[model samples]
Target chain A: MLDQAQPMDEHLGFEALYCAHSDAIYRFCLRLCGNPTLAEDLTQEVFVGALQGFHRLKNRSSAKTWLYRVALYRVRAHRSRHESRNVSLEGAAEPRSVSADAQYAMRLDLSQALATLSPAQREAFLLVKCQGLTCSEAASVLRIPVGTVKFRVHRAVNSLQSVLSDTPEASHEM
Target chain B: MRCSSVQRRLSTWANESHRPQEEHRVQVHLDSCEACRQYQSKVTRLDYLASEFKPVTLERDLLPNIERDGVRKGSGYVPRVFFARHWVAIGAAAVMILGATMSTRRGGAYSASAQEAVRGMESTELDRTAYHQSLWQAAGPHQEGQLELLDQVWYEAGKWREKSIPSFGGDRIFEFDKSSGLVRLSRDWRGKIISQEETSPRPKQIDLQEFCKQAGIEGAEANAEDLGTRTLNGVSVREISIPTYNLQRTLVWLIPGTNLPVRMERQNEQHGSWTTSWLFTIEYAKSWPPSIFDSSTLESTTGGPTARASQPFHDAESGTTNESRLSQRSKLPNRNQPAFRTGNIVFAAYLSTTKPGPIDSACASERVAAQLRRPLDSLASEYGTLQSYGSDSHDTDKDRAAGSKDQVYNLRFGNHPVRSVMSFTLGSDGVWKATSLKVASSATP
Candidate 1:
């Protein structure tokens, strides 16, 4: 069992926190935003929020979850602000210069499928499936119920499976 | 269980969330039913695919930027309810008005000159193999102490590299290879490579044009005013200030000949005071040595320091002789008093004695409290341990001012590893007060 009281270390400073959890936060944001640039901005914004409200953090042990919550809030804010601009997730998933390997192709397929998911489903699935957070943890981060998280994750998985299966080059097992 | 129910439970079972009885029922159903078995297989494959998805890493660590800029406007602590209720409408309206005004504004001579300079910069073909050095510093009452950094970047087609070294913090070297889209970060401690992390492919490159566009100076909101020429490092440069939202300003010193910015400064109006929060000076080089970009060579050149095992603070405390500890405690001034003994006694005393006659004491106290809380809040985010020593009081001079006699207390506040001593002056009625605080550095010791 992961220690519940381990996130906030009174002895740990900002540098240490950045060193420890920044990569995880970055990955989380990247998976949600799809666009690397947007993810980077959102990640930075999360830390900026963390810096401002550090004193108001009541449960020091829940820093990681708290950071995810902040990131989710920032992502939502960014989406709502730019909603009128007609931003598309599919457009955000531009091809990168990676090797044309089977694994890469499958990853690309997964990326497209992920972009097709509803925002709530995508978030829940990413938290529970990709990021490896428990349903309860995902609920806490998303500020939704555990049942809702599980349902969203289930729906996201079903949608991804369907999309991947329908692709022209669906040579991969799934 | 029915096929419909079994299909629903299949996802739960695949996620390992179902109870033993449910798992047993699911297993029995999977054994008995073909359609549910296929559904289970698909869910399993989906889970596998999801697990295989790797997250893209950032090209560079943004922690330094956050530390320098502090908190931006929207990210601050506004009540969520209030923001939700009012921000959307207010923000949309403001953006529309600002957009219309900016679009209609005629370009002045200064603005035209700035645009020409920017155009020159955008058109200039950067060298395929180039080296750049940038020194970043904060200038204001609250300097980002220990956060100042120098960046040395080496760039080639499809590859970019930078080594950032802080004055008082750790050094980091980042290499982003566009071909592989992989970003590698090597963190150094005491000349040794403490750790290294390689991220997934990040194809985007940091383009100066993109930066200019993001700053709202490319074409959208060209409010830049060229402030003639100034000599910097024996080169003539054009200085321009671009007014941004929230009374923020971006000042750039661009070399007219090269159209490249030698220096850029950001000023923000924070709490009724305009402070130059960010300053950057860039220097260009024709080329860097090939060996400098090689990871193995760089690692070998920066050898690890002599390794010493670190002992816990508690262990060191326990090892100290009781007599010596007692002597050290006895040597401390005002040992019997409740006042905090800070490093900068003069500044603390001056702040405590100086009265803000016109400023409301309650408002002043709140402002002081907020200012003092900024660093502590930052430290708390890092999980820095805070220790507070009991407060001590001292009587202030009654003859200097006609107001009531005041008692000042020195309070010790420390986020372990970093300490600050603050002085607070309270009037006789205990309503009026003044506070001054300073962060203790190694120099103070």
Candidate 2:
């Protein structure tokens, strides 16, 4: 929601939108997309989309929900097409090849345990813990039940405890 | 198990994702409990550092594509009403229904009187081609003469003074010969009218067995017991209401004293309860032409079911049916008239939007009712459905319902009502063809 988002009277009124929500939105996209290069591209596209249909908006308060809905749709589309894990995540996994080996080293020192999580768990964890959203709101964003959100976060936390507690389940399973 | 349940609670406490009331509850819990506190703090660093690891940004270039998509969708022009004319377009298939004689007060506006039941009229538009195709394969092989009938009757509902006329809309497919009396009904007749929004109250007439298969319900019988007889809507009739079924299985005022049914009410049951929400009445009926019940019109296998109970408990409502009268057909007559003459009638139609068309005013005049049937029946015959309900709205002299629409003469023998004219046609053999029928303005009766 923005005071500047007044029913796009000007054709390129979205230029203001790009400056307004772009940073926080880019941060959201960065986490969701898991790659800086792709995230930058997705963040711009999301704003462009919001601008194109800005005339139909009756209320400015709805912009948050609308922007989030659009951002997720793009995230889902990107996920579908890129079946292979092509981009380097900051700390999740050691990608097959990368130009940013120094960046990868710094990422590795952060927390290698997060790399062990399932994609669903990682998404739930990131939306809840990193973004400071409640489990229910994160569940809403992820389109999952609150219970499943709790369960995945629980398992992630348990595994994280194990990774640091020196009694990891991976040791038993392997 | 102790740890497992608490682990769920721990998951609840550790849930940093959902930022709603649960998070508030989890935050309060963590402040009190030592085990959860250590657990949450461990969860904090693990997830916090992990989230930033894959921090990526949205690609900006894709915005053009999304914008292009929105513009393309908005600019692409399509007339909203264009697809409505096509029968299969999911919007146009409607039977021209009208008439529920209100007991009007001194000023000619509708008012609810003690006698409020729609009756005997059977009107429905059937796409007869589907039945012919499906039956050809199901029946294996048939002689050129074998005929299958999927008779549908749509009752015309009357209007009231409140602009609150209870419209009876739903389709019933009673395929002539099915072993279990497997009648497929959507929007049960004999229920009180419920909704305020307008939708296609009638669903497409899918095959009965296929309908059951889709709904995941057994078609043979309804799960109901007899609640016994009671007087409903002034008709001393059997009242049968089924509550524990997938769909509304009740049949209210099902048995007709006159040839036409007094009224049929469908009560929908959801979540172990029923709401008396829909109504259909058939107030007018005379014997259909002799040809309607002829053996040649029989569609099902001879040994197919009659009124017998084929599955578990059949609805007690249908118990009164006379199986001996189970003739595969109940066809409307197809009369032989070759040329347009003095008695030849033509039916014409106008859409509800067609600039205050002829049929709009026709509702007020009985003379228009007579003149319109010829072309309307022609439309019906094009789809291979024969017409019933005699030229005089009241086919039989023994009638209880009183509406002037019943008294109008269909000189050309067209029986279907002209609501939205689905099509127009001319018959090859004679004047009865829908195309051949013509409409000329007549002196107001």
Candidate 3:
């Protein structure tokens, strides 16, 4: 039994942290891996790493941001490990669009457009656009310069526009 | 401003956070230049479209998954140095054993003494038994710390009751009624019952016989060895050692007369070091009253049934209380609704107009549906369907909040056959809203 006054109970604190941010982390992994099952596995693995390194976590304020950073690294490592087996990130399964509603269809079109962006751009775009992180924050998560994040987001937007324009509905809407 | 300057700042301008001077310059350029204006509009549209992509929800609650995989405190740690040298042999043997165990139905071998001991323990009947136990784990070199005490447990075959008195505060009682298939947990804070919850336990049977056999103890090919007799806690016991394919050494201390386990210890050899993984000591008792297992006794001993105020009353007709039943019914999707099948995934939506009664209201007097109608007829709507791989009936928890039921739903989309999930919860207004929706590629077929 651990002392209640201890700054943190390793298992319980990690469980609390997981409960608070697992959904966001799952969404991040889902977008990055393009496979829900793989994303789930990656999410579990990320937390396992978080548990092992919990004692070393210096600043608790940036736990969410720190988790994202860890997730990004794990995703990269997974891709690299699978790359030798001919498992391409883009080749991962795509989500099927069930609703024929124009809005739903357009969302699906945007998902496809997102897939066409470079991996770096996609990461930046997801952090800034999907995850609502600022450029500077995204840079910190990705361990890149703020300028690189901006450039990636800019390129991602441009590529998405170009790809979406190829479809008649998106072109007409624009 | 030059068209070149405006072109460079186009992204910044579209993001709507440009400096006032830059914004004015970009606006002037856009107003005057058709090409830049088209470019600016396209960027804005792209941003809008991207923002419209809903955040995906996980098909299942990940907390349980995390808890399942989460490392427990004081679990033995195996250094990487040890793993590097012996991991290959261990991994090969583990894979072979796991394959054999899963693929075949044949029982494994057990020593005659081990079998007799297990049979004796299983055959021994008791009206009720009470015992106290203290659990300990190794912290570091030269340190073994007390983890917890099983304070007390009243056991009667399928039904078992246990209470935990934490070091800091509060006492928790866990009662499992196997026949009823319900596990009730009540927590007492400073002698006041603070919280109580009832939930159905997962339908998994603990097969001790199968477990012993799988540990390479029972089968003809088993490598179980008798390490002679030893006295544990003043009781003379026979010691048996079983080495498993996973590099785990299991030491069982069995009483020859009763064939009951007095103490068991498991150690794992990894990376050239042996670490104690688990240790359990059992003390048996002959009898206790059947009434000891009742919740009423717990309440009387602790206090009055004050905690019952927080829980919904159980309904006799339906297993669930009326409050939970209405909540469940209010959330169920329309069965007549068409399911959307895209790729290997199928989706469905359920919308309801029912208003739930007040939380603590009696089942008979409360209107099942609300009297105050919403502007929209339907208060809630949910989209998603659970399609398990091979299970005939969809296994779902009735007491779970509307959208977050725990079940394995097939979520394969596009060419990738990954599992996906989507669920919703009902707000106070009786409107169903998706709590989570997620799709992931399956690692296994």
Candidate 4:
């Protein structure tokens, strides 16, 4: 139950900090990298960085948002080092209960559509939509203005709509 | 509002930050505009599709590992004190009953300093040494059934052999010897060999240095405390304890004269009582016979025929003995009775809270009903179906005294990656009841 307003104090140990934010930070990293394994590593790296600079965090209320900033920085650095590797949203295991054909088709179409988005748009869309971050919070994480985050998310949504609507399944369903 | 402006506002609309007047204005425009509504529908679908991919739950908690990393990096954050005393001597009878051999006397006689003993262990050459380690739950056997062997490994020089019955891997035996440089694997199902194969490009070799590093031998040496000598199975050995962070303790026993460790045990005091979580027994030998590394030996040991032709192993055709295939057929979960399936009831219990679904009345067992109600009560605000509950490892034991079936199922709660392992036990009447819920990973501070 760690909220933004929870102040950093002596009672809050490193273990508590991790449990509250680990899931959110991990999902954010996954959306950024599109790979679970890489997301896990980046999540670890981000926490390790947080541990080192924990005392320097003066704005305790923005702790969760600040952790996302660290994750963004680490993912950027990782992508630079492993430039040859491509971000893949494919290979995610579909749930057993879901309709295999329809789920698989939607997954394939969405994967292609997401791949078409620019890195900035993808980040903006993921933060606001997938990770459930507010535009202002996402803007802080992305180190951009709130207006810029809105613009990018707007463009990303429009682009995804255009690409996905082209699919036969989308046409039939809509 | 114009259509263009309304669309821009719609993009950030998911944040639900629109002013009341602006929202009404956008609603008016969207009501008249078919294009904007279509655009909104597609965007909503896109969001739904992208939400399908969740980050994989980590197999193990990273707190201890991250803490170790933080310590290594020498961060400014100072960790709290772990142990009150460096050297603590508990009653010998208690230790002996718990299967830890320690001196009976108040301060029994022991040779060699803790440093010397650790040095001997650190210097012990593992090049030609044979190593064997097995994991066992201390109280599990005494509580209900015999001790369960979670993992077993045998390694000598470049030769290695491992036999495990992980929930995912059923019963598997794998071996590799440097001379052959080939990995021989055999998988068994219900005491019968299902498949056997020779895989090339041998598994990675774990040298002595790497083994010691992984085991934190150096860390143990730094914090080693002598716990006096005791006779373990007629062997004269000295015991040393290393108290680590978080109330966890590691005890290592070494041969009195040789100073080579013969056993290492990890104990946790989380349940208000000390329990040996993992025990590693080591034995050193000059060399092992080639037959030990052979695949035929595995077949003979597991009591399964070496040739696949001898056994009728077809996944689709059950009752021939593949338990995995048999479980797959029990898909229809009966509400009045327990599902009798590995993962069905847990998901049913989880989903019962979110919305009306199967197993509402079928949750007859108080344990299962409590599990169903507890999540809903705690997570009242957030409600969602059980997204994914993949049981990676499953182990079942028969409690003859209690006349019940004990089972462990690993589950990952969606979005929140808490690795919750729920244990279920079936009573004599053949009713499945959840025995315990253990959270393998807790949120870190």
Candidate 5:
């Protein structure tokens, strides 16, 4: 939770919020868009939009969730305008931590499996499992009920299981 | 607890704080059941992978980029130069409007003059432009030659929809929506969808630049030879041949008028002679049917109802319904409308820096034609041809007056200095004709 004494409308307050939440938001955008350059652009756009509407942020404690809502909206708007097609992890720069070829292949396969899930399920699952957000927190970010978030995440897991089961060796490739 | 219930609890167990009793029951079920144990193991593996996959760390601080765009740390001010400048800066190549024309195709030798033609090819907006292509593999003449259809692709904006015609299974349609970051693959047999799967979008070889690199021998561009013009399917196309050191040959056929590639043929040196292996034939489109990109909604040309009338695919994030999107597409200026036709002709004339001939003169009255001439010549002389044009609605009152006898439109030509207002009237031949053009005062912001 942010310090309530520092108002988000001011420069120092916003900077504090930005410093605290920018990396999380950036990671979320990258997962959503699959393009580092575009994700960075969207991250910048999210902050700009959030700063403009800072006054509407009534509860300073839920600032991270609020920023996520703004990021999702900005990403959807960008998609509508550009009509961009498939951008895969294959095109992205290789992650420095990953050294083994088998592990890299497994990651690619996982990416392909994740794509099979519905948009709603994917968003829910990413927030809870990948982003380390609780179901309640993700529900707040998505503006859906907590039960719905759990249901979507459950369905996403089942779907991933079904997809990965086709190539059982994928998980064991590493 | 059953395996299903245990798996559900296990999926969200990390995110939820459950009761001790419920947790104990789940643990007991997992210990007793091997299937549930495997499921838990799979879940754990996926969790590890999902966390490790990408494992994104910030490459550069975005706070600075955001701050540079007027979202200051302690301030509430955002400048008007917000997304447009930043978007264009990053996407300059995507939005660049080139008025590139084909140079005269020279014969035999690869000279400096041919470089102009190569530059024209490179500058062509093949990626940004909307096009449909048919991939075919041709057998040799001695081998009872026939062109086998491998795949057909329709591309618009950044979205690509490809149909792979394989011999084993039914035809499959793979759609890659870049905007939504989704790839939908559907199988269709006799215009009926057998099965459909939506996956994460992965890019295929839809780019000519990428295709050239893969098809050509290394440094094919440097050693390219211009083979001049050849008539293909009744249209004249210029051929550029790039032969590799490994006895591989790639011939690219480009339409002379638009400088867009129509076909690329790859050949191999077999028996000390070139034999064509496969070719990709491209067709450019002004616009495509809305349903072409969505396989679930596509009306099959094979006389079968490929569309599932019960459920239409909905893009929830776009905030616009498919019906609404189709309606919005319908509202755009009909290319066949005489007024729009005249506007297109005038725009084309402006592009070529040439005076309109009899056809253009026939569409306008003497007064309106005279009014259009001076500014057209001056703008053409100073700015060259306008790269792009779209209907601008800055003046709502002017647009509201549309469909009346004297219709007014504020058309903004891209890559220009001014935004001009054009007025049209119905001609005697039941076509809307340009009546007058107002320029000079409407300077672009």
Candidate 6:
């Protein structure tokens, strides 16, 4: 939130990167991994990995992007390590399908829809809509063309809308 | 409006197109058009509803705490730099001497401006040969010892190998800590549950296979195919991929650090792999207590499903006699080539010009009805495969291996979508095999 990437060389500077972005990263990871504990551990891991490979960081100014890249990359690697775990490409719940916890229901359906989209599409949508990255920034993080990133986001959004529309409540919500 | 034009406008307005001038026209047109207006409303609703998918924001204070804990404990990357100035070296007499050097980003370690540090750094002399020699061998004293330490850790961990065995297709599992010279093998059954997730299928059908069985997968059919070699996280490994076998292709990365495949993957056909990259080194727990290996993975496949059958059985491929020759070649050294043959037979059954004649001809054991006909009464379904009007033997009967020597029994499919799916055959060993199973007609690309 506050130019979170600390000065690369200073002892205090390194601490600031963690202070600034760790929680945001942890939260992002929790949503991605669908587990709070794992998200927390992964947040630790992402930073640890960043530390291990910190010397490779040629430009410190792009530290925020770099951190996000590391977090997302670790998430990807974790997904791959447990690669066979099946996360179906189908809607999990509808808006009406979630009544007890309205906030949770919405999140569940959003997650459900996001899970259905390809990984690239999900990353694009999250980076642009949720994390508030510009298409270019998201593209840089993803190392894809801006046009591809835009396409992925649009496709993800359209599919998510369709997945949500499947529920009678999402239909009404729609 | 043309359907295409309407679709474009609908897409643009749904995206909240960024042009101010066009916004007026779109809004005016949408206001008049109920269908378009309904679509926009639907889209707006979706947007409000989309936030549910986002992660919960962390408490503002969590970062500082984590940062504080992480910095001291974290590992750092240092770089390769030398203090000798080329100009200074050339100008100096026979004696070599240097004063000091300062810069940012050196020796795989991140450091701020060297001049700004609290104390001026001392340049320590490094012996090049000795440093290289130490890498092949471990850096510390305990490096050259037996894995007694890790064995003790595995014994105490309790879950040494119970959890992870099910995930793999029964390949050797080993982990090496370069820092510590310990190689933990799964005593014919050992591994840690590195990760596990419950499968949530939307339609809630029974899973693809009953109870993720460690069914007797004879051996890894993985061999050199579309191969790629590169050093991944300092582990020199070879990565190979096969496009078919299932909707998702399989990738096996064989780590040179250990002769085993350290990583495995099943990538979706469409997006390839979302997480194939960014795989770095696997960090072990700082220390494993002595109680790790007390638990057991011995009966994992023994009782549940494959207990009795997992023991090597003669399939159409297994090197046993009861099975036919065609099935045996399907298990050739060129792993995919043989499977490619069996898959061809499977495809042929799907695309036979003659139906009902022989879904499986080799099962006949001996010469039976040479002229088997398709059951025309049964409407051709996707399962029966689109049968045509002739047999494969009817096409030419000439083969390079046979030279018209042996007769091939093939039911041909006519009026087919692709000319490629027509031809099928057995190998030089008289095993039923096909060139490739191309189901491009299914629109799966």
Question: On residues A1-174, what C-alpha lDDT tens digit does candidate 1 reach at each position?
Answer: 001112333212455445545667888888876678888888887877776765555225466788889888887777777775876543333222233353345544776667767788788888877665667778889988888887887777676665566333322110
| A64-134 per-residue lDDT for model 3 (tens digits) | 66788999999988888778788564643432223335333454467666776667888888877666465
Runs in model 5 lying further than 4 Å from the true structure: A1-12, A55-58, A83-108, A165-174, B70-445
When sorted by DockQ, best at the front, the candidate numbers are 4, 5, 1, 2, 3, 6
Over 4 Å off, model 3: A1-16, A55-61, A87-108, A166-174, B1-34, B73-445
Flag regions of model 2 displaced more than 4 Å: A1-20, A55-62, A84-113, A164-174, B1-34, B47-445
- How far out, in Å, is residue A44 in model 3? 1.6
Q: Whole-model lDDT, candidate 4? A: 0.44
How close to the true structure is residue A78 of candidate 3, measured as C-alpha lDDT? 88
lDDT of 3 by residue, B333-403 (tens): 11111110000001011111111111111111112112101100111101111111110011122313433
> How displaced is residue B80 in candidate 3, in Å?
30
TM-score of each: 0.37, 0.29, 0.36, 0.38, 0.35, 0.32
User: DockQ for each of the predicted structures, in order?
Assistant: 0.12, 0.11, 0.10, 0.18, 0.13, 0.08
Write down the TM-score for model 2: 0.29
User: For model 6, how does the per-residue alpha-carbon lDDT over B1-445 read when each residue is reduced to its tens digit?
Assistant: 4333443444323222234445446546654777765665554444434433333655443433444454556544322221111111111110111111111122211233322321222211111110000000010110111000000011112222211111111112222222332322222211211111111111111111210111111112432253767566675776755332222344555544433333434333212322111111111222322112112321111111111111233323123431131121111111123221111111011110111111221211111111121221121222222222212221122343453222222222222322112234555665433432322233211
User: lDDT of model 4 at residue B298?
Assistant: 23
Between candidates 2 and 6, which one is better according to TM-score?
Answer: 6
* List of clashing residue pairs for candidate 1: A10-B383, A10-B384, A10-B385, A13-B382, B181-B201, B338-B391, B338-B392, B339-B392, B339-B393, B340-B410
Worst 10-residue stretch by lDDT in candidate 1 chain B? B303-312
- Number of the top DockQ candidate: 4
Alpha-carbon shift of residue B79 in model 3 (angstroms): 25
Give DockQ: model 5: 0.13
Q: What's the distance in Å from true for residue A10, model 1?
A: 7.7
Off by over 4 Å in 6: A1-16, A51-61, A84-108, A166-174, B1-34, B52-55, B59-445
Candidate that scores best on TM-score: 4
Tens digits of per-residue lDDT, candidate 1, B201-232, equal 21123233433552323331355677798888
Model 5 CA lDDT for position B41: 59
lDDT of 2 by residue, B313-429 (tens): 212333322221111111111111210011011111111110100111122122332244344334333422221211222111122121111222222112322222211222343
Ranked by TM-score from best down, the candidates are 4, 1, 3, 5, 6, 2
Reported per model, the fraction of native interface contacts reproduced equals 0.25, 0.28, 0.18, 0.31, 0.33, 0.15
